[model samples]
Target chain A: MSERLHDRTRLRPPAPASIGDRVEDVGSPALLVDLDAFDHNLAQMQGLADAGGVALRPHAKAHKSVAVAQRQIAAGAVGICCQKLSEAYPFAAFGIADIHISNEFVGADKLAMAVELARHVNLSICVDDVRQVAAMASAAEAGGVRITVLPEVDVGHGRCGVNSTEALSRLADAIGEAPSLRFGGLQAYHGGAQHLPVWVQRRQAAQRAAEAVDGYVRHLDARGVSCPVITGGGTGTAEFDCQSGVYTEVQPGTYLFLDGHYGASEWLGQFRPRHSLFLSATVMSTARPGVVVCDVGLKSVAVDSGLPRLWSRDRSGWLRYVAANDEHGVLEVLNGDSQALLGSKLLLVPGHCDPTANLHAQFVCLREGRVVGLWEVDARGLSR
Target chain B: MSERLHDRTRLRPPAPASIGDRVEDVGSPALLVDLDAFDHNLAQMQGLADAGGVALRPHAKAHKSVAVAQRQIAAGAVGICCQKLSEAYPFAAFGIADIHISNEFVGADKLAMAVELARHVNLSICVDDVRQVAAMASAAEAGGVRITVLPEVDVGHGRCGVNSTEALSRLADAIGEAPSLRFGGLQAYHGGAQHLPVWVQRRQAAQRAAEAVDGYVRHLDARGVSCPVITGGGTGTAEFDCQSGVYTEVQPGTYLFLDGHYGASEWLGQFRPRHSLFLSATVMSTARPGVVVCDVGLKSVAVDSGLPRLWSRDRSGWLRYVAANDEHGVLEVLNGDSQALLGSKLLLVPGHCDPTANLHAQFVCLREGRVVGLWEVDARGLSR
Candidate 1:
């Protein structure tokens, strides 16, 4: 391992630049974050949160980086929401100050890890059942941490969380009854709403998710239970969620590096891609008649949602990535025509931004298409 | 980054064992590579490669680890083959001499990187077109290193490589025309045959691939072009390849870590799976009547091929990973029953072993269900 680390210094370092300097000479398979666009995305979300009269708890799951969260907080985000206890552990340790793990945790070990994180930062975790609340409370007591707990209600994504108001109240009551836990609020996140391709579908999904959470909140109010926060909304449906009035915090992450799928969506096309993330791969082989092989493949780009787009140059008529192995991507030229030559460089816009971001260890900051700085992805793969 | 690394180490370490210790942990998702079985598999391939009189250049793309490659080499492999230059870089840097990149090289910067690496090791790269040969020759001249170059011939996989014998000769002649490049052999890998599911289909594919390569070999021989090596074969078709007499080296990587997809194949089930690889995940939430949440998901496991199998447990009828998000996996209890309780650990056999191996940074070596040692996945995520 020590021997491996010896070659680290040999990696081409990012050239120092003035404010407007265009970064060049950075290697391929890099995560390029456009600072200007990233900042604007943050400010826009903060403005939306303010106008909606709701606290903005951005979802770290979309970015999973403390640096991005800090920028969000500086722009007026109340806190950040994380999807996993393992994912939240690094952010809490990095002094993010406030974090809401919006997923229910059942294991005592993970609950202990969460409670330990709460000792360092203000932590709130979600629970859909009383059994989870008991385990969290026990871990919190053992760790000497008073943790805030939220009842996660399934609004549209039928994965986990309480499906009814009764289940929400039972879990909330359990949290309130526990010595080391406090009932935080309702966590009603509609994960499916983030991927709705049309504006009408997104708006309808947000309305349904909002109504579900509103019903839970009204039930809590009837019982004299004061639920403070209702957190959940991704970048795909952030606009619809802002006007919904039911959500107290909108958790959007991909706005920092909007992907090809989001760019193609009718609902999100107007959002203007930040183009912050680009996988710059060199054309490795252009020998086959109309095909090209690239060094980046499934290991470099995440294709779970869809294939990556040719971001820099849309040689749509000539070539495109057809399939990918673990380390090599296969690009077949269309119509027996090939414009991409050997030794050419190409920029790839990953299909799913979040998973692609998770694949890299660091980010190369680019200004006007040149590398200027570098930032560690910080929490690249903290999937517990 | 250091802090995140610290957070990762907080988890329990794997146990160590003596050479003869046969320890088993009662759970699923635990990667159990049976030393005896793995040794047998390696020896079987070694014997076949030796009898066929071919140099065993086992492909590293499947395992992507130095430890596994070392074992393969020690078992009688001449060196190793890689799918990408980046994949070969780490192994080459770590003193794994005689490496052949089974793919092509075209990008000047990437070609230069490959040439620079050749300065420190015995490197042979593949090229399927004249342009790639020119770029490799240029880079090799610039780097002041002489490197072997192979012409990748497409047998049946409709990906990269030359289509005909004339194209193969033309590529070889182009390489011979280069000043700094030496003509190596031919790369005839049939990627599709590795997943054929049936022995007859696999054998038929191998025979077809062999015929295509034999035509090229005969053409090259008539043209007086020395065809020293004809390298290609995967775990699924290695047996047929050895008997075909067309290949001069067999490159099989997946036999070490037999995945769920490979293990479930009617043709491949005969290969024992306990020999290598399993994903260890903890049951995070099981409060839902017929659903349980796991710590691993799309982010942790590769689902490109299919969902992972609940390894070696009778709960196979009761448990199924029905859905997965980026970080959380939802396991559905089919019969509304599960022996897997909250906090119980489960070992999942991944669908595709290669991509899953690329996700992690290290392999936890366990002996007797406890911490033994840690082996770094030295070539992890080396896509470029």
Candidate 2:
């Protein structure tokens, strides 16, 4: 075990940049956080949530950095939401008292992890089935930890959560019967509605989701059950969600670091998202005419949403990231000299921030073209 | 620095499976290697290389594990190829003396890394530009290291490398002039031809690439330069590449762990690749009828080549992984009950093995339903 640890310590690459280094000195394929924009986005989202009268729990799954999470907490966030039990560990260990695992889990291993985490922090989990409730209850009871349970009601996401009111009621009753469980509220998240592209469509989707949650809440109220918190929403639909008057808490993760996917979406609301995250890549090769390959590719950025866009301050659109291979991102020089771009640093706005941010070990926080600090991606590769 | 190290130690999640643990006991979204099939792949690839009379230098960009690389070396592999200079550090530190950076690099940071690596191992790197050769020569001279330089010639990949024989001659001459640089040979890799579904198309592409490389070799020969090595070829075209009588060595990274993309390709040759790599996922949600959500998703697997395919023995096509979100894989139950699959484990053949392997911290090696070993993905995120 000691030998393995030694190997790991040796295997880790040096951080891309150090404090007080120029932005160009940062290594290629590093995740860069524009601190100025990051701070603006943070305060902007907090103000939006405050104005909407909803508790703001930024999803830690987006950044996966304890430093970012601490900033979010300091910026008036109520708590944070994690998509997995293992992903909640770093936040919990770093003085984060409240965390909600906004997803479902099963099996003895996951149950053990959940119960163990409950011992350290105020842990809440979502469930859509009676079996899951029973298993979590058993594990929580055996661990002597009270786990706040949220019956995930399918508010039109159609992926996870109970579809019907009866199923939600059954899950709530099952949690109520468990001595170590507390019925927190409802998990009404419409993941599909987050990126509808059309403003009216997004608004309507959020409205339907809110209506479904309201129906579930009314059903619970009729059964003499008190619901305290209703948490849902993402960066794309947080405005509509908070305005729906049905959700008590909103979880907007990507609002702090807008990506190409969200940048292409229609934004008519007051919550203006700034592009805080950028992939610092170097032009590695300019062998082909009119085309240069950057160091960022499938391993450095996520392409599921779409290819990353080159960050252009003047919107010149001179360089287009056309394709991505495993270790090379092929960029076509629309109107610039490819040779001049060689060895030059370019900032890229990743298509999707979540998976792209997960690819790097640390974030090179930049302020006015100078690296101010480095933040560890604390929960990277913690998909378990 | 000590505080940061402590935080990193606390941030890392526990390994999914300990040695000798049951296969089912492994945590969800863990990279699993079937030892029975893995050993067969290792021996089979070596046998193929022996029969073809070509050197087998497996690309470490695929598995990125020292244990796997050590096994390959023990099975008669010549050396190993890494796509980046930073990636070669682990292999060098772990006592692997021969390493090749089979791709081009630029910038002072990359040059420093190359010089540092050359001081520790027999480091070989590829270059296509004279400017790159000049920079590398200066770095090697300053570091007092003799670095092997391979001129990369474009042999139909159309992404990197020099295009014409004139360019190749210039690069070779530049390398020969450098006092600290040894003109190793040529790098002619047709990455685009590696995944053609039709066998004939792949063969023709390999033939064209071989012919182009032969032309470059003749050009070098006419210039009174003796090329010691001609390296290039991936898993998809290794068979044709070795028999072409041009390539002295082949770098077949994915041959050891056949993926869905390769499985879907036509293999009319004797190289019977086996599916040894798998993503062990468990069903976490069965909320929607006829569909079950597994814990494996974009964070756990690479979707660049295509979506992963469920591994089924007996041709039972009961489950299909239809969609992947950030943290959930939606599997459609074709003929089986979704409820029965809840909390059950399923082995998934990743679409592409390289990036998928990069997503995990370690691989759980399973032999006869029990974990025999855990191999760290030593250079998991060393993309720079």
DockQ of each: 0.34, 0.53
Candidate 1 residue-wise lDDT, B1-384, digit = tens: 112223432432122222333234322223345455566677777887787777778888877777777778878889998876667767876667778887765544467678767876688888777877877787788888898988988899866788887778788988988889888888888989889888788888999999999998989989999788888888888877877888988888877777878886655423333445777766766656788888778887888888887874766777887776787788987885442467666777888888887776655555445534445677766666
Per-residue C-alpha lDDT of model 2 across residues A52-143, encoded as one tens digit per residue:
89999999999999889889998999889999989999888887889999999998889988988888788999998899999998889999
What range of 10 consecutive residues in model 1 chain B has the weakest lDDT sum?
B9-18
Q: How well is each residue in A33-104 modelled by candidate 1, as lDDT tens digits?
A: 777777767777677768878788888877777677777787888888887766776676666779888776
Each candidate's fnat, listed in order, reads: 0.34, 0.56
Residue pairs whose backbone atoms clash in candidate 2: none
How much does candidate 1 score in TM-score?
0.90
Pick out the ten consecutive residues of candidate 2 chain A with the lowest summed lDDT.
A1-10
The estimated TM-scores of all candidates read 0.90, 0.97
Residue B198 of model 2, lDDT score:
90
Give candidates' CA RMSD values in order: 4.1, 2.1
List candidate 1 stretches off by more than 4 Å.
A1-26, A268-275, B1-37, B268-275, B338-340, B366-371
